[model samples]
Target: MTDYGHDLLFGTFTTPSAQGAQHVLDLAVTADRAGLDLVTFQDHPYQPAFLDTWTLLAYVAARTERIRVSGNVLSLPLRPPAVLARAAASLDVLSGGRFELGLGAGAFWDGVAAMGGRRLTPGQGVEALREAITIIRDVWDTEAVGGVRQDGRYYQVVGARRGPRPAHDIDIWVGSYRPRMLALTGAMADGWLPTIEYLPRGVASLPGLNARIDEAAEAAGRSPRDVRRLMNFMNVSFSPDDDGLLAGPPARWVEQLADLALTHGVTAFFIGGDDAGAIERYAAEVAPAVREIVSRERGHYGSMP
Candidate 1:
């Protein structure tokens, strides 16, 4: 068995509105009080119901002292690498090392194009994301490199410098839904946030996909074990009487989650919902049971020290 931190990588997401922001912050306080590990907010510039990820993370960071804050996955093409690098570093400094960065090349062509970002072909987007990660890491490096420039095919940075380098390395999670993106994440990221669920289709394809990732990492001279594997389940709930309920009761839902972890290799799960009552049910009933199960599975108990 692999040694791990708090196993139930539980977190929250918010719709981007004034009311949604307040609702999310309230959940942050609740998640913190309940001993959750991280809270994440998503980004969308064109949506009428969106809030700024960096600004909101900064606010959440200032308000909570113990819980970590993150973006579920920020759109990399939307900002210049230097600007994003500095913003992430500043947030990391303010949060005392509790900031995690999740990035993706981004979908929603209409939204990004509206803001002057050209659409990227799949290959171009992946290249851009790879370059973004490289630049961000160099900027966050406390030790200087021989050169301060990144000359990737899709992105370039010259004399790019910033920081008050993060107090600790910022954990970077890249969202990926395809083989190419998965291999890219394996080559460059700290974690893999798979878009697919842990169903039979995913299970059947795992070995081949993971082998490809292994090949890519080996080609890059990186160990496959260096990266963490994470999964996301949108709209999860527990139902004591009905497992069919997409949003069910607590005990039933927690059991499904435990099974997912034991049978599959799901180390982390990020859950999403639009209703307050659903989130409350998750935090109050489902979260505690899942945490207990994970602790027992690890042969350890109590909160992380």
Candidate 2:
């Protein structure tokens, strides 16, 4: 058995294009074959630029095993809680419980407007996110609480029941950029997955984000260790020369990630498949190294593999 958190795991985030779905599924099989831990798809609707992430992931899930699947970050605000919960629960059950839910306060204003909905202000969206999560969780656990209730603001759930719970409780990861978002993530999410734009680069920026997360978790009376820290990183290929990928060389990457696990309480890292050639390259050059890395981390983190 391998510890899910200890392993320096890597995966892909394919663009939500119909033409890409088949490729995405193919890549998923590739990840499983290559022994990678997870894969994710981004969610959006009627963009005319991407495929429906949930549908695509469902497609991929049907054809593979071992590899965990997730939404890079589902736009929770655009969806009604009961419907969304059912969708995720269905996926969870159908996929043999290998599902992760990545939730984000929808921010694509134009897309929202196009859907005949107004864009939510930052504050408004966050509040909406809060309500949305609560509603979904409630529906999954009980039959008479799946409807809507309001607290003088945002969409509220009344008195509806949500039954037929998912086979397993799915892990939830929240996306964040601002302090408030990060704070919320620390308090409520099972994990944190940040875009590359916000992940720390210099020595200074990194510590602050880590500190805030710890502070928030502590204040909330949750152990910082319970929440995972993950970086949404792009897999940049080197000519066997460049500084390697951000997670570092295969073995070093595992070591570095373990250090981060100890420091920031991170257990997962989402690797995006950017270059068209990354799949082949990782399969050939990076995959074997990672297998060994996981074996090492297994000695320390306990096994979920």
Candidate 3:
């Protein structure tokens, strides 16, 4: 078992549809009112059908009272790291520390190039993301003696001033899947956020992938537990029959998620959908049950002297 002992978190992953602007906002408000921990939106800057994620996040932050907001995984190619760090901090401050950064090394190369962003190879993208993370942290280090300075191959910040400290220490969650990216997450990121559908071998792939991350973290002189495991389920159904991983009833979901927490150390779960009713059911039933079960199991293990 790989329980990291972090508190469980449940969230909604909704599409930021430009056409259904009001509906998008309503879903965020619903997640908030239903007591979900986080409300995230997919970020596809080149997609004209979607609202600008950063703008939507700021708006959602202002609209909701308590729920945290973030891009499901913001495309890093279009967003400059220095500016992104400052923007993240400013939003966190404005939102009363209710902002988490979910970043991605760019995917969809054609769209990225269409928008004047660099079209990098897979290896190059990982290197760029590494540099970007360093620059972002330096920018957030407001108490540091001097301005941020990183003459990286992909990015260069020649003594840029860092200020407007975030209201809280913001966690940078990286959406990663490949070996190098997973290693990067283990070495640098605060959390690992990967969508279930993207995994090559589904749930079975986690242990091997997680081993790579753990090895990288150990090599980086950080504990494996330092990286919080977060997973996103894109196809979830609150139905009666046991269809698949997350396609069964809430009780089955509770069982499956509890197992994930105990066996894989996934402390956070994000359900992807736009259904308000499903979100409500998940928040009311699945989340609490999973938390209860995980807590009990952890207590049992903790007491084993």
Candidate 4:
């Protein structure tokens, strides 16, 4: 087992379909009440059929009491880093620190260009993401002697005032897979966010990718533990018997996910589903069972694990 020894977290990913706004909100509330650790939504600024993610997040923060809210991966190319940092901090403060920043180097080039966002090449996207992280973190540094100053090829912030500090330390989780992005996550981000279905080789690819992150972390003088690992199960199918990855009943999910926690050290697993009852099933049934099993087998999690 890899056993990075991080605490386990459970969450739900809801699509921001404009027609299903109330249903989405209700599902988020259900997840929060069911003791899920987080409630995340995708952010696609150029999508006309979707509700604005930031607006929905603010409403969710006001409605839910404890569930940490975030973009499954907010498109950084469309959001100015300084303003995004301030918005995140404001929400974090307002929600009593129940917030995390899940970011992505831009995707959907056509949609992005339609919205007046630059359609960056893959390399430029990665570099821009790095620069954005720098700008955002600097903007959040209330203790810095001087203000934020990041003059990068893609983004440049000159002496921007840092204020409206977050209620607690906010985490920047990057959704990345390539080598450069993985290294960036290790050196700078607090967590690595990747969807299981999109992985080139599923969990089979984790060891190599994680090794890259670890090496980069060590190179940057940061412990590998500094980068938490979070994965989301996209398009799950629940049934009464074992089928496949997140495709079976609660027990099957618990067993498979617990294995992931023990073997790969992926502490957080977010389910991409919109059905409220199924969300409850995942939150109340699958999540707790996985936690209990991992805690028992891992030891350091104690009884609560």
Model 2: CA > 4 A from native: 1-8, 143-152, 200-204, 244-264, 274-277, 280-305
Q: Which one wins on lDDT?
A: 3
Greater-lDDT candidate between 1 and 4 = 4
lDDT digits (tens) for residues 180-203 of candidate 4: 899999999999999998899998
How well is each residue in 54-88 modelled by candidate 3, as lDDT tens digits?
99999999999999988889999999999999999
Name the best candidate (by TM-score). 3
Ranking by lDDT: 3, 4, 1, 2
Superposition TM-score, candidate 3 onto the true structure: 0.98
Candidate 1's C-alpha runs over 4 A off are: 1-7, 145-147, 196-211, 244-246, 274-281, 295-305
Residue lDDT tens for model 2, 155-189: 65666567557878787788887788878877888
Residue pairs whose backbone atoms clash in candidate 1? 16-51, 237-248, 238-248, 238-249, 239-248, 239-249
Q: What lDDT score goes with residue 161 in model 2?
A: 60
Candidate 3 regions off by >4 Å?
303-305
Q: How many Å off is the CA of 198 in candidate 2?
A: 3.7
In Å, residue 40's CA in model 1 sits off its true spot by 0.9
lDDT of 4: 0.89
